[model samples]
Target: MIEIFTVDAFATNPFKGNPACVCLSFMNDEHSDDFDQLFQKIAKEMNLSETAFITKSSTSTSTYFLQWFTPKNEVPLCGHATLSTAHILFDQHLSQSNELIFETKHVGQLKVRKLKENFLELDFPQGQPQPILLSETIVEELKQKLCIKSDIKGN
Candidate 1:
């Protein structure tokens, strides 16, 4: 049976910060279409912003294969969810090493290290932001809604 956990990341207390559902799967076999469907189903049921699926790497003791899914679709990367996954692993003593590596399909390897004072550090590649053009009317609307008195800029 797969183990599941709901963890709150970036929170000092329960019910605060972002909550993510983490599913721990023991199956080391290659994922099939059915597996993808099942993960999506579970994410939908959880109804969270993102759900993380983690499996032990077949080659490394400290490495795991990780995937993130929203209620509707799969995403390439999610920081809060990744942190939640690492928190679960470290909290449950699932990893023998203090440093753990997570391999993602799109983002390559993400390294997470446990720190003092029950903190965890994650190192991942930075995302490149794409510029989007916005009309002046839309920008004005946004400024008004956000109660900004100064000019707003949007590419």
Candidate 2:
């Protein structure tokens, strides 16, 4: 039977952070049309924010095939789910190394390292956003939604 685990990413306690499902060897090949259907069904069963399917990839010795799916559909990249998968691998000793490289369909290989017990670090590609004109509409919305909250004991 395939081992499926649920992990709460970025939280010390369960149910605190975004929960994701990690399934090992969920499928054999990606070429099958039914593969995606079954994956979505499993994700729907888990009913989490996202579900990750891990498979042994032949791209490299350190690379593992990884795919992410939401209950509704598959997503390109999901940080929390990836983190959850890494946590599971390290926690259960499923992997031989503390560092892991994941091969994805879109964003290329991603890396993760175990920092300490119950802690891990993710390597992200550097992104530089192009300059854009400030929109008053967005500013007003942000001000209305997330303005500020501070009170130093009524000081």
Best by the lDDT measure: 1
lDDT of 2 by residue, 117-147 (tens): 8878888655568866556666556556876
Best by TM-score: 1
Q: How far does residue 140 in candidate 2 sit from its true spot (Å)?
A: 2.2
How high is each candidate's TM-score?
0.83, 0.77
Model 2 off-target regions past 4 Å? 27-34, 94-96, 127-136, 143-155
Candidate 1 structure quality by residue, lDDT tens digits, 33-73: 45778899889998999999976677586688899999999
Give the local distance difference test score of model 1. 0.84
Q: Which ten residues in a row have the lowest lDDT in candidate 2?
A: 146-155
Per-candidate count of clashing residue pairs (backbone under 3 Å): 1, 0
Q: Provide the global lDDT of candidate 2 against the true structure.
A: 0.77
Worst 10-residue lDDT window for candidate 1 reads: 25-34
